[model samples]
Target chain A: MANIHDVAKAAGVSISTVSYALSGKRSIGEETRRRIADAVRELGYRPNAGARMLASTRTNIFAVTAPLHSGTYEPAHMAFVLAVTRAARAYDYDVLLLTEDEATKGLRRVAASRLVDGVIVLDVSKDDERTKLLRELDIPAVVIGIPDDTEELVCVDLDFRAAAEQSVRRLADLGHRRIGLLGHPEQIYARGSNFPHRFRAGFLDAASALGVDAAFAMPGHGPVGVRAALDELFEKQPDMTGLVLNCEEPIQASVLDILADRGVRVPEDLSVISACSSFDTTRFHPPLDVIPLVAAETCVRAVELVVEQIAGAEGPHVELVPPHYSEHGSTAPVPDLRDAR
Target chain B: MANIHDVAKAAGVSISTVSYALSGKRSIGEETRRRIADAVRELGYRPNAGARMLASTRTNIFAVTAPLHSGTYEPAHMAFVLAVTRAARAYDYDVLLLTEDEATKGLRRVAASRLVDGVIVLDVSKDDERTKLLRELDIPAVVIGIPDDTEELVCVDLDFRAAAEQSVRRLADLGHRRIGLLGHPEQIYARGSNFPHRFRAGFLDAASALGVDAAFAMPGHGPVGVRAALDELFEKQPDMTGLVLNCEEPIQASVLDILADRGVRVPEDLSVISACSSFDTTRFHPPLDVIPLVAAETCVRAVELVVEQIAGAEGPHVELVPPHYSEHGSTAPVPDLRDAR
Candidate 1:
């Protein structure tokens, strides 16, 4: 409730002196600064947000436009949001959350008003309208997913293509000639979601390059849909020795359950790898080998780049965070029929 | 990036006239208002957040303090957050998200600086420290979850106790003499989360009143844990003909899967009910009866109450949205065991 004048009077200093001590824009004596600090604590005087923004040209807030559409996997979305929040907090910044309802309008309002110094775009689609708006706004922004257009936009995301390639390579090196890919729901791919398309392409391209037999299936959700997907995958590649799951957690868990139901042994019968998964693979029945989708790695980097841009550091560029793979004995060498005989 | 001065010059009006037109603090001629609006659009002028705040004494923002602790179920948490965001938008307010790391500190900072018009608290624990800090700050705040101490706080939440009691009564009316409850992870109860404890107690009390045998178990996660919980429940009440699931989606799915695997048919053998579940229960194996935890119901009401408080209307109070039950053929009359024999 106390204003600058109250703080000044209590500290026995001018309003300008109090502002300087708090802002650190100008040097003040230690005794005077301590007195100001004591007065501020005693009176619970908080500098007005408007006054601070006018003086410093920074509100120390970032607008995080995370649109949760119909196809969003909540766990992954929540993870990324929390990661960005924590990363922003490390720089003494707070996040203004913008949901799907007012995606672009929210960004525009916050940026135009100088309420936030920069923006962090999340849940980006291939032809995202927000990306175009961000480009036009020319505000300090970092897109967490690769959009169709990259010109004059700073972007950061997991190298999904590389992750897919690595998952195939890991299985290929294990002497698995036949592999099956379980992708996201069909709508996710049809909706022009950027990452799933890239991951699928990478999987097919890597399979082709390695001369490995690969079949792809998109599971809907739950046990029934997952079972049908597995049946379709087996029908296409009956000799499939390895499987790569590139879908949400529930579907992946269902796939594992279905496999267990069918008496299929992991690693021994079918080597499995969880690609670009945000959830913990170790929790799976047989802890899986996973190219984990690390939210913090990309989100932290994105926040840092946006902060750098806010400080007027450099031009826009795309930064791809490389994926890290961990094995939990879910993958193994393909079995030889002759040896078994 | 044009300032008010630029807008006024372009509109051919005094700066004071432009301010009055934008803020609606004073009446201006229609022609002058239209001219200022055109100037604002043409020059891409945005009202300064600081100036607007100082003038109106409002930030037009809500501080949403949602702490995602270890026990948090992501889907439920995300649902509440999104619901609040949409609801706040209805009243022309944006959400400033504050996470677990700076739980109380974030609330204090936002409230003290008057950066947010009000606060929306989520994922409340029994002994939540934020409630105390909120009381001290004396800011207009509405807590979405009920904490242990409700004095001097505006709280909105689902009536978990009533939902639990209603679930038991629904089964009891159908001649289910023995009932079992599958609750959340043990840590959720051990950590003093408000709802689960209330729900559990209500279930026990209701069962006792109806003279129906009752058993309760807390499942960790996955098929194995769910199976163990079911086994524990059955061990306690072997003739359990009705079941109430108050756990996460995966655990509930696991229960259905395990029951199916063991040749236990829904409604015929076990009349299952999902209590306070956020996810669609129809997606389960055999669509179970459910008391849905409608996020929008509580969150929208909470936002409205906070906005009212911000407008200096009424005192702090608690509001509980009554639970709605939906049947999906998961409940039926208990089988006549003697007649069957």
Candidate 2:
């Protein structure tokens, strides 16, 4: 069945433009829109979700470039790549994983060889070399994470800033005056990782606006790191009643365990929420209330954007997915400490 | 420096053949070895370790085909891919990830595309459709995990069966008379997953050989699953003195937590060991004694094997990485039940 890729290819516009023209998300040139319409008619394309996913095309391959940093493969990064690969498959497209030393050169090879019809770039930092290279390629490219300046690229990511703010606000709404935000490693911030930095900024902004006492810093990962971080948090804010964790999966349990060891009751004495990507937060002990960045959804969007662009979607679009947080088993109204006192 | 990939290309053979010809791991045809030597000498190729990773190739892209199962990505599987990508980067090659509906079709697409000089296939099952497909491809391919029969493949994997046996024997050596083995989900076994099945068989076989009573089955994942599995284990063997877990990461902590909650002291009353791919077993509370499958090592080996094959390595081969286990805080000499009585 004809799908978005075909219409975009036929129209010589980006997938986003075709989508915008179809859904009126953006203003498109009349000539381009007419071409798209003509292409849709000629190709018998259907702009439906299921059809978009199963859009079989001339080339059923995607190049996904998310390299391991210094031979250490981060699980979070893996989540993004995995999601994109799986999503591409939904469209009957195979993903060619690329972990290139130089993004520009790696992408150039893939594009030159026509190894893939589209490309999905993972873990875009501010001023990413990959994004710069994406502009030089004719193949449509989508980023799993947003770079600082996406003027010439199409990108999809969770609005991490909003997610962080929502998580902090959720704690505040639970009537907690003193809250804590545990983040990624210190080096992650020092290196100016866009996502972590955005989350940190959003968290602090929300905390300031709400007039809440907040402690923000990178937590050490694993049990030892969690112990040190937890001890430091309680020492810094003895009355802290909620925590927002932005660390890796390995450290979450240790955070709660340390709190429990210190006689702090979850929800009763302290509420905790995580800004994680996994949806199975409810299965964690005490079932954390969470603001999740659904990796799969973001990945699917990226694949669609890239495929359409390759088929002729518009250039340079940024799509920030909204936050999805739930008040599950972990968050509750703050206890009346004044009454206890 | 001219590296292995160059030699393989020049020799008109798979890189693996060149590696085997050099390392004597497999027998290479005399003519092919001579060709590889002639290519190496002509290209000025150096077989040094540093050069091995940075074997600057003409294509500089490797195709990795490990599709997400039913659009769901498994973390363990991701570990393998991540390792391969990182390892490839160390050698200055790019990976082209592929997930085709039919392994046959996917391998064909990647091989035919010439997008990648070589290929790496992840998680080879007993009768992996991909390996069968791999045999037809002109590209040199390495399978990360061993299949039921490797008569037509070069493969690398953790000797899972040996790892399981080591864990079971470790517990038995600790004087644990009865033990429980928690495993992967039921569908994994039902679908005839090779690795899990091998581990189970090995565990049971070792137990019988040691005259140690053992109970084993798939434990559902996460905290809830951990708790239920724990309850069932205890119920089945009230005097169970040891536990072997092959569950996911989320549930590992829960296992330790449940035992702690039950006033069961790790290593003091009961010993535990896991067949996991993660290397940070020591960071968990009580620092689990484990037989870890170093995904990174396997990945590095896969890349190496593939490169060598392209250089004309000989024969279908299986490289079984031995198990690496240690007596960490989670295991100890089993408490003497008679003495306690």
Candidate 3:
């Protein structure tokens, strides 16, 4: 509730003196700093963010741009946002969230106004309009997702291709010869979502090497989408013994329901694993076998990289967190083919 | 990309004329207004938010105060925020999101500086600090959750008590005499979260009226919390044949796992229903029979009510969205008691 003026008045010094003491930019006598600190404690004064930034010549704020939808902030995205925020806070910085539509004007305004020192973008497409703008502005920026043009930009992302291959290898190790993949809705992949395509390529490469039949289907994000995708997959590959789900939330639930309805036992009649974030798998009904991917951790790392770039670090930088899978109740070896039939 | 000056220059008018044209305060010649519009379109000019707010009497922005946790932007909360934003956008407004901790100084700065026209507080506690501050500041505001001190406040919320009662009655109608209630975590309830307490009270009252044996427990959000709570609930009341879940996402998954692990068949061994928002229920696996509560709808309604209040509408107002349940695949009659025994 206490303002800078209150702290200054309590310290019996000018507001400028209090500001300098807090920022530690201009030298103040030890005694004066101590008096200001004591007054701040007494008044419970938290420095004004805008004024502090102005004084320090650093905003200490990172901006993130994502789509603005009714319920788009799922656990994965939320985790990413929070991770960036907490990590920034750890480094004594704050964050400003922006929408994709606002990126053109918003990024320009925030950067020109010095509201943020840097920016980190999420859900980057192959040819992101924001990326083009960022390049033109010459602002230090990082992309959470891979972009088609990463030559001059800093980025942090999962090795989805390797991750998918690893998931398939694990299933193959369990002696599953027939596999089915449940991908996100076609629209997301069609929009050039790098993850899904990378995942598909990896799965196909692994399946071919293992000499097995692999089927792929794109499911909607809802239960209905899940049911339809599964129905089509099952119809196409009725003998498939393993399932790999890449869709988050809605489809995850629907997949569980479809399996339950058909009385197909997990890891017995069918083994299941997914490339979902840890939060997604851990929170579902039957604990899913999932690769432990944390979007938030990735976001945090990206923010750090962007901050470094903003602070004058040279050259394009890329960081990848290799996918690690955690087994829960969903995966197992191929059942007896005859018995399954 | 274009500044006000560009529009003004293109229109052969002063910057003040451009500002007035945009604000529509004083009547301008029809031809001049058309020329200004043409100039704005040609230059792709957009109003600068900060400068516009400072120059004009109104900010045309609304601030939403909520929990700062990563989970705060989950589907339910995200829906509510978006709904309010969409509704506000209809009236040519923008929203400013603030966490509870930021509300005091944040609200004061925005209100005093006229950065926003009003405030809409969500996830409100019985004794909300933000609400108190807003009242003291005499800022036009609406609360999305009910508070103990309801006087002089406009509130839009579901009747959680009634919803809980209805859920219990539905169970009882299906011959579920022994029921268990899974409320949100103890920490959330302890923070004066009114919904969970209201739910508990309502369940208890309804159960008492129906002369049914009922048990209650608080589960944190996530699979671990769900498992722990379920383990505790079952240990305490093994006879409970109906279950109600209140925790969102992470816990929702756990609920399913615990049931599956315990070999408790849903709708057969236990009928489950929860006071969840529509999005939560719709996306949940084995789609839950949900008390169709929507936080965003409530928020939008509350925002409208607040706007009315700011426009000099009459005294205290309370709006309630009635409890409506969706029959997903999760709920059914309790299995015959004899078979259970």
| Model 1, global lDDT | 0.90
TM-score of chain B for predicted candidate 2: 0.78
Measured on C-alpha atoms, candidate 2 has an lDDT of 0.74
Residues B183-242 of candidate 3 have per-residue lDDT tens digits of: 787887777877778778999999999988888888755556677788788877887889
Residue pairs of candidate 1 with colliding backbone atoms: A50-B50
lDDT per residue for candidate 1 within A1-341, as digits (tens), equals 89999999999999999989987889999999999999999998999886677777888899999889746888899999999999999998999999985778899888888888899999999999898899778789999999989889999999999999999999899888899999999989888889999999999999999999999999866667888899999999889999999998888888887788789999789999999999888988899999999999999999999999999996988889998889899998887742465
Scored by Cα lDDT, where does model 3 land? 0.74
User: Poorest 10 consecutive residues of model 3 chain B by lDDT?
Assistant: B48-57
Off by over 4 Å in 1: A337-341, B23-28, B337-341
Candidate 1 per-residue lDDT over residues B101-170, each given as its tens digit? 6767888998888889999999998889899998888889998878889999999999998999999999
Ranked by lDDT, top first = 1, 2, 3
**Interface RMSDs of all predictions?**
1.1, 14.5, 5.3
Under the 3 Å rule for N, CA and C atoms, how many clashes does model 1 have? 1
Q: Point to the candidate with the largest TM-score.
A: 1
Q: Give the clashing residue pairs of candidate 3, or none.
A: A80-A296, A283-B253, A284-B253, A285-B257, B80-B296, B222-B250, B222-B251
Q: After superposition, how far is residue B90 of candidate 1 from its true place, in Å?
A: 0.8
Q: Could you give the DockQ of candidate 3?
A: 0.13
